[model samples]
Target: MVIVDDHALLAESLELALNFEGYDARRVELPEEPPSETKLVSLITRSQPRIVLLDLDLGQHGSGVRLIAPLARAGVDVVVVTSSTDEPDWGHALHAGARTVLSKTMPLGEILGTVRRLNHGLSVLDVEDRERLIRAWMGQEQRIIEIRRRLDQLSPRESQVLEHLMGGLTVGEIAKLRVVSEATVRTQVKSVLAKLGVSSQIAAVSIAHQADWRAA
Candidate 1:
């Protein structure tokens, strides 16, 4: 088994535990600067381990989900062990061809049992559960696309005003910054809310954030 996680301590602990449990587990420490997908795949291929434990969040790479497909092609089976609470990430990992995603909070015994089951040609998750998570990921992706479409409806000025709102600025502050009247800023804010199909500034800001909206 190969463990690919950023945290040194956690990796060490898991290495010790798995080794003690009679599985040859080693940590694949990534470089300080994130490597290219090709380089990453090369390192794992060196060991050619049957199973690789992957973490979804790898610093600069945003998420390690992209690694799953190439690794699978290399004949490595990945079992995601993540501490992230993002349901979308969990679902995304499964979609990228992970064996199963296990929470860090799950009991150690249960995790070991999962590995043991895999060794014996058994699955940890049912087909229904995998389908459910994949469906959830697809739904979240659709929501992001829709929200971004709404953001696209904003005029350039309205987009700037929305940015100010997200930055915690008051209408008067935005007006002064833009060299415009408070009334003008308020009107833009209203237009922003309307175009976003939201009722308030907070809702508009939340939608912008959820969609990761930003000017090119």
Candidate 2:
């Protein structure tokens, strides 16, 4: 087994525990920048480990979400061990092909059991975490639907204006882009805010970000 986490103490502790349980375990420090897909495949090949216990947040380096799919493709199971309470992180990790997402707060015994189950090709999520992940996915879907509905209420020009706003354009910048007067752009901005039920450009932008409206 290999553990990939930024925190040295936690990695060392987990290494100790796994070794005590008679498994060959080691901690592989994450690079400052995440490795390329080919490099990652090479590392996994070299490690020849059955499971990878990964952490998403690697301080300045960034997320481990990008590692999951490649590891899965390489036939190495990934168990996401994170302290993040945000549902999207969990959802994203699972969607990217993690074996299971485990809270850092879970007991070591439970974590060990999860690892063992993965080694034996069994699903390890508890019923509660499964339901929570489902709820989180449902909530995200509903939010996207709502955002889409609100966006549908906009005129084509208004939709264009909202996209610019979410892209961090000022009223003046947007007006220049649309070849319209600043006043006209401001009017469209107000219309967008009203339709989206937001009070300001920042609020509207926040909604846009949450809904991933730019992608739409």
Off by over 4 Å in 1: none
Give candidate 2 regions above 4 Å deviation: 126-135, 138-189, 195-202, 211-216
Q: What local lDDT does model 1 show for residue 104?
A: 86
Lowest-scoring 10 consecutive residues by lDDT in candidate 2?
36-45
Worst window of 10 by summed lDDT in candidate 1:
55-64
User: lDDT by residue for model 2 over 1-216, one digit each (tens)?
Assistant: 999888898889889999999899998865667676578556655768889999988776568888888888888888999999888679778877787898888888888888888887887877687667757866887887898789779888888898888888999999898898999999989999999988999988888887767633
Per-residue C-alpha lDDT of model 1 across residues 43-148, encoded as one tens digit per residue: 8668779998888877765577989999888888889999987777788999999999998888877878888888788988899989988988999999999999
TM-score per candidate, chains pooled: 0.95, 0.69
Give the local distance difference test score of model 1.
Answer: 0.87
